[model samples]
Target: MEKIAITTDYITLGQFIKFIDVIPSGGMVKYILQEYTIYVNDVEESRRGKKLYPGDKILIKSIGEYRITKQ
Candidate 1:
């Protein structure tokens, strides 16, 4: 598991994915989101614009776990 600090109240899933280096670019994030399953707070999430807040846990298939924190 890894911890990520967010400077804002929330971050979009696509932004978070890129922030964590899960995907190389914005164009690829949509494709990756559609191809794989990403869990937000233990629920399957497919929306690229899904909002993630502090303490949210994201499970990206084959990528690893990421926990969010407020900075």
Candidate 2:
């Protein structure tokens, strides 16, 4: 379980870009979304700008499961 520190209560699309270790940055997310290569809570997430809240799980095939948490 890797922890991503977030000062804000919710994780925004822009902020998530900083977490490149788990997922690629910039156009990468867009590419994934366009290809339906991402999932949120088991459902295929096509919105690259979707906000992730605390306890929310964003799953990428290459990165596995990443849990969003508030710091």
Model 1 lDDT tens row, 1-71: 89999999999999999999877888899988988889999999999899999999999998899999999
Question: Pick by lDDT: which candidate is best?
Answer: 1
**lDDT for every model?**
0.93, 0.65
**Which regions of candidate 2 deviate over 4 angstroms?**
22-25
Kindly provide the TM-score of model 2 when superposed on the true structure, using C-alpha atoms: 0.70
List runs of model 1 lying over 4 Å from the truth. Answer: none
TM-score of 1: 0.95
Colliding pairs, model 1: none
Error of 2 at 37 (Å): 2.1
